[model samples]
Target: MLTIKRVETVVSMHQQLEQVPGCGRDCLGNCCIPGAKLPLYTFGIKQTLGSNKRAHTSSDDHCVPGDVGDFNDYEADDSPQENYFLDELLLAQWEDRMVRGLFRYDVTACETKMLPGEYGFIAQLNEGRHLQKRPTEFRVDQVLQPFDPKKFNFTKVGQEEILFQFGPSEDNVSEFYEKAPVLSSPNVVAINVSPIEYGHVLLVPRVLDRLPQRIDQDSFLLALYMAAEANNPYFRLGYNSLGAFATINHLHFQAYYLAAPFPIERAPTTRVSYGRKKGGVKVYELSKFPVRGLVFEMCNSLEDLSVAVANACVYLQNNNIPYNVLITDRGSRVFVLPQCFAERQARGEVDQEILDTQVNPAVWEISGHIVLKQRKDYDLATEEYAWKLLAEVSLSAERFEEVKAECLKAAFEGPPSDSMAQPPALPNGGSYNLLEKEQAVLIKSNIHKANSMDGVVPNVGEVGVEG
Candidate 1:
């Protein structure tokens, strides 16, 4: 069991301790001031306080001093409990809980190396076998299969396949649902049966929808609420769309608590304003490493968050674009990635085998951490090789510019007036529509100029698109 304790300490020798800089008070708020007693507690790490003599030394030299009093006067509740701070810090005692079970897998099993050139880093995940074995050849007609409650079981809770009854009426029922969940209400949060990382979790809607696009604002907000409840800076929340490498058809979002930051988290980002929604939710764009995507930074208002996400969903649905979304707890930042680039790569038209894997670009892969299942793929994985793979899976310069333009246009003018707008043609001889003809015309003209000057298109894996 992991036990974390915070102890209070003070200076024993008044003469040995120097007065706090710029403050006239002593170790005890105002020990030198007669007839005045101000209680102040100095919290320090238990490991640092070596003996009883050293325990009395001031933990922070800059802390203002106060009058010495009975040590018991400062002793407060030391009972094991969980405390979540506003700064995304979590303090918890795991002595009485089964916290040891949470870390059954070895985190160090995955190998990470920074690739050369533009590919930031690649994590050769030997534990990605679960994802590789998932069914990827579902028939188009069977894409939206109905839920079967009899087949559903909360196996993690128990060995028995417990059945769940959704509602009083037979018609108002769910075929399958999680009987035991970590967090539940309109949505359910449960531990992933096959987690890539320790404490990896999934947030799914109770109503049961195959596609994430079908998730309503209520369910979306609930998932975000559950993520915030984690309160740990290590955990990051994200989602993959239907065709954007989501293995399960059920509408769900994923969360994982990592000891270290993902490459994307540390990568540099350039921010650009995409304007604000009618409800005042500010929409923006973050480009460069990680993956280029539209961002919606929400305020405290739930209504504003709904509006921002609703607009983004409507835009993608209208354009027939599959996408992935990620929500970071730190800044309340939402990343919306249209899977145009990934979809193109899935065709396997290119001969490039660099960082090739069975799975397509998903939320984790787009976030600069590509997982390799095959031994050959893992062996060939390098920084430059990883960068090339991501570049191929990422939106091209021209396509990205068009996407940014459209998002900004939608933000200012409101959700598209036409929800039935057909996707435009692709640059290559394909039916894929990433932009409208007129928009493509302008983008192609700019591309032509850049290509003419350099004899090759700039940012063609050389650099990323500017925000």
Candidate 2:
């Protein structure tokens, strides 16, 4: 693996404020004005609210929009609102970090386009009684440490507009993104977005067309490889289907990069437990933090890896886990990792019945991780779920043929929307249309999924929810 140099990037708060592409800023100004409680990516990352006056203005020391940490207390904001008693905790963190020279201000990307009925969507956080148990720690999730932008040792990097500027244009990059929606074959373009704690980046197709539900192999993997290569690479990548946590109606992929090593679960665990299983070797442990142990027995080939994953999940399920599984080949052996389900239960915020009750295989459309709703910096369980979910729906030889058949069926079943694009390449070895694919993957950011899956759900028994 190539080593990525950890270089210090000096992004100034004032520069970020004035340098924001006038055209890129959404009409609602949700980017800087505060829309949710979570701080996606902060310029002055090392700083927080009420930290140092040198990093930021004393009066404007708090978050630009509003100090939104825990989302349950999310209130509608037209402009900056004077809040402290409720926001003090979160704001202080940002300010505190600012006092120290840890993190700083940097420009960010997010889904800013608001549809006809999109304004009040952030107001729909079901803090009330939901199926899944909400974590006690999550109670304060509505409030979190804010991002300070002053600490960034600003040294003009000079003329770097093209780096952040993405997406296809009808006029500007017409040559780069030529294929039109109607003119191109269906299922040719695909888009997916995710939002995690801190580490965040937007990955999308270059085309200006709709996003695809299922992509072919080469194109899918290429998309990941390409986006992973972006400057502000995400620590953890995420994808939300049309109505599944997808805040934006546009086609794109939102990645959570700040909170790398995934610090969501309480005492999040990353130890590779070793042991044995039926199919082959086993590496199973508690999913959501404070791990129990791991079991790695044996491994002969890729098939063994696949079987081991299945076996591990079966064991956890028999233990009444209803857990999440992440399977990957590690040194010629398949590694099966299990994240137990207790954090959600402890929080009294998880919906156990939603998976079985509201699951709609047909309309459920993009399967895998469909059950994912809320995400946090400490919830290792949520992190594991995303990893496993990606494996379940990713493009591969085993399921691409089956997925392709289903994508075709969905296409013929209904009229395509501008938001919908062409067939996506599977996860394995296919290629992406350099131009159109780019535009099709365009998206804002984590504000990506305020509440797109309010009533939608995924099939609990089965992971893949195809046509």
Candidate 3:
């Protein structure tokens, strides 16, 4: 219950007390983090990117690699041996916190069920998650905003809420620390007191830096590393830009465990090739889904994948276009969705029923996991209802094409070659082309089928969202 101002006062008091390792407050503020000890999880990467210095250069502002030559030729390394243990430790520590009553409510007791339909959207009835004070609202028209110290941020969260510190190791070997001194600007993984799903936590990269909720290469790479280290397909991470229902303008990613697959994950996707031959990053457009999104999957290295998506995010924010990103498929696949949900809501275009439900339709909801604040919505949840509501989140077909083209140009460093003007025929005798006006060239291969289930999707673990 400590305010940020109060925490600063306590920090000054502790500084005068001979620079103690930690104060009894057990928070992540300046008072306790200097020499505080926490469990550390270190991961290894095959390749490293450029310098971390923030660049304002027109070309490198998005932090894409200067050259990604032969990235696709690189051999894939198996998941680190330590990842098995790391995943277990993550769930174990998360559950231990649950036992300690660190969350706002018992999310496990909440009713959850999968709605009946082809999409099989999941719904949860968690009325207890309602915040006593409405979440602080940020200006929804702008995507980029300066970090305001007076506003709430993760730095004010208690140390007890943090699960661990995660970062890269010195070498190619994954390592763990039972108790390690906190880094000056550690990448902290902490619990979301208001839980949306089991094991719901926030990954705050370089917490002490107090970065505004804007995606850069380094922070996005850190998020990818976490996803890779966890090595669980069900353990997915997500992001929301300031205008995309992000109440707090702090830089953080939300993650949680859901045993079942998201409908968006199962949504059929078509490969959009700019006539590039088998290298670097590949982009796919979602087909037959309520929302129109571009999926980026790695063809080269994790760094390439992270940068490609980061570039897209930078495009969205720079233009004041709000968006959401879902990092799924064990960090291999990512969905960059440019949404107009908040914009529509502002213009009174969103239906009254949807507005009445008070569902913000952030990353999780866009991915087919609807968190209901009322029992009535949960009881009446259906695939048609879910589809219609999310349909409003999508940008118009023409606008999406414009945005997608720019994203592709940004992602690939330039527009596709003119030779790629025509639709290409697949080896399977199927031809892929743009759905309308050749906006995007789509291939029919690599389709993902929906998961088959009989009844309620058992919720054995926790997943989360951050705004």
Candidate 4:
């Protein structure tokens, strides 16, 4: 096992190499040095907020011509009214929610174009870097400091104490309940504190405490339901896994309003029926997009959509793969990005040089925009550079194809019967009625006997003071 001391030593060695003369500037250190061993290629967030800021700013700075007027009008207001209503619904949820003051409602819609040289740069980088034969593994408990739920003291009633609580168990229901003002309990939609766009909101399960890392049928259905309800020509819904730019571990889906569609939304479908499952979801591969991912058109029936999403989540969870999910309201299409770079970083496999850039691509970045914190990074950022950053964090073409194939198979095959992982029980000791059929199959298949694993899924049944 890799110990903390060993990890620190390895980091120090890389830092020392960076200081060596003629070693910086993408030489990737020691790989070029005679008799030096080649280091593993890994990626990480050097500056978490830096990349996020860049993404947020890019939205405004690169607004499409038609959308520029909306941004200008928003920015022209000396003190824009915080109260925004979506139809008859008011954003009154933000009034008393925790972290309400930190929310940024004003959004600028900018469109970033891919540079001609982006493909070439990405190819060159991929050819230069040697892929690791195996990924490094570490225990979350060993790496992460114990979480203190109290660190976030926001005004939302009952939420101040449960903001960072480990799971969504019964004990935390009240606290987690207070985190977001309830929007629609039946559909489980709630207004999020952080607003990348004017109508940014979250869709969560009404009774499950499962985290985003392990999505179940109930959460998936709720997300689909909420997205469908919010469907319009100007709204998009998305999800980010625990390591894939998700600020919180809780299971939630985000929806935001866009004056104009993102590049991905408008991009023509390159390949339809890239992969499909009989009586299941059809996968489409978008052509010429900087990020590599698959898109699924929502099924006509809720049962089919639930099955497809459940199987997709099962495949991802079983492989320990992290991903980002996006649902377009206009097309009823869902985009899934199986992420490798972020997962590698979580496993302590990323290199120092990549981390130094502080570029982490979450849902926004994958959707065709990026955020850069430093002036140097922002100024240096081009279409080619942005694509290069994405390529560094994205799965290789061959691996992506393999993942796509497996996901298709899973959707049709209906999850492996031999797998021990079971759907999490609901909060009130009641199972999701919508998923009862799948749950019954698991029970008959004896999959529920498997012990709920930590990191893979939250153990909601057990309640103990973590610290």
- Quote each prediction's TM-score: 0.56, 0.27, 0.77, 0.56
**On residues 89-133, what C-alpha lDDT tens digit does candidate 3 reach at each position?**
677777777666666667777788888787768888888766431
Is 2 or 4 the stronger prediction by TM-score?
4
lDDT of 2 by residue, 170-236 (tens): 2321111111212121121111111112222334442223333222222233333322222111122
Per-residue lDDT tens digits of candidate 4, residues 200-304? 555545322333235666566655544433223345677776556655544567776655445665444444453344554555676666567776654345446
* Model 2 alpha-carbon miss at residue 194, Å: 11
Best by lDDT: 3
Positional deviation of residue 210's Cα in model 4 after best superposition, in angstroms: 5.4
Model 4 score (lDDT): 0.44
Q: Which candidate is the best by TM-score?
A: 3
Once fitted onto the true fold, the runs of candidate 4 whose alpha carbons sit more than 4 angstroms away are: 1-188, 207-212, 268-277, 343-354, 426-429, 434-467
At residue 83, candidate 2 shows an lDDT of 17
Determine the backbone clash count of candidate 2.
118
Flag regions of model 3 displaced more than 4 Å.
1-24, 47-82, 132-134, 414-467
